[model samples]
Target: MQDRAEATRNAVLHAAAELFSERGYAATSISDISERSGRTSGAIYFHYTNKEQLALALVDAHFSAWPSVIARHDATARPALEKLVGLSFAVARTFRDDVLVRAGARLWTERKSIDIEMPLPFVDWITTVERLLAQARAAGELAAQAEPSRDAPNLVAAFFGLHTLSDVLDDRMLIEDRLANFWLLLLPGLQADPAPRALLARAGGRVTTGHPARVPDGTER
Candidate 1:
């Protein structure tokens, strides 16, 4: 019974995420999620007290996926410059493929009137990225003057800039192509080594020569 209830809850979240992506948070109705998930509105209410709570839950789920993705590329295993470059590319790929992530990215800037407290999970994700960049600096992956906590926000802004522009440039260059180009251009400022050039080339190849991951169909994973 517990497993079944959990499954139902997940189903509702999955449906809600899809609807929220297609229609912004303010526009998505609880009834839409109910119809999409084949569940009653009362079931959704049982799982989440209200739409605001549901939106926060979706944000939490999306942010939770970042740490595991970052962990996959250990800073210690690779040159710091390479690690930083790899992290950028990995994050771009993750962002482009995940609709919930895309939606959450949109929401982070646009959300209003939620009355939520500090976004602890998001703060933690940013801190972890900063830590990784700091590790890269300590390991001589970055310039001696490099500071991750101070600089990571700029890098994050650059990343979002690329993401935002990718949609506009989709006709001129594929989103993956734009992501590679964006990273290539930004990496030089972060590192003092020439290896970033090669890494950028490899990343471009990975995107242009490979296929983009399909957009996620559901949120259960």
Candidate 2:
């Protein structure tokens, strides 16, 4: 019974994510989710008291999704700047493909209309980027002027803007390439020794050429 109930709840949430992504937050309602999920309105209410709660659930899930991704890359022994670059590509793919993430993104953008406050967007993202960049500095992967605290926000902003444009213009068809372009432009100035452009594949992550990872030379970064 517990497992069945969880499945039902997941079905409803998935339906809600689809609707919330296809239709903006204000435009989506409990009824829409019900129809999409083929679940009774009563069942939905049993899992989620109201539309606001449902929306909150999906948005919160999206927020929860990133940490595991970051943790996965961090767990590996790759260079931090490489991790940073790889993280961006991974995120771009998720934002493009994941309906729940799209719903959360829509909810975030249309947060003004939500009666209840959603988690403040971008704060965690900024913190994660800052941490990765700090690791990059410690790894001697960053350029001398690349202050993590100062640069993290700008990188996040650019990433956010790039995706926003991608979402608006073409349902994110070109986003992977566009993001790779972003990395291409930023890498030379950002990395201690930016490697040849092997092209970042958003479907996976950054594709590197055969060049070896940089070792920290005695000179200051």
Per-residue lDDT of candidate 2, residues 156-188 (tens digit): 999999998777766786676667767777877
The list of candidate 2 runs beyond 4 A from truth reads: 196-221
* Candidate 2 global lDDT: 0.81
- Shift of residue 178 alpha carbon in model 1, Å: 1.7
Clashes of each: 0, 0
Where does candidate 1 stray beyond 4 Å? Answer: 118-126, 143-150, 167-173, 201-221
Alpha-carbon local distance difference test for all models: 0.67, 0.81
Q: Write down the TM-score of every candidate.
A: 0.78, 0.87
Model 2 — which ten-residue stretch has the worst lDDT? Answer: 212-221
lDDT of 2 at 201: 43
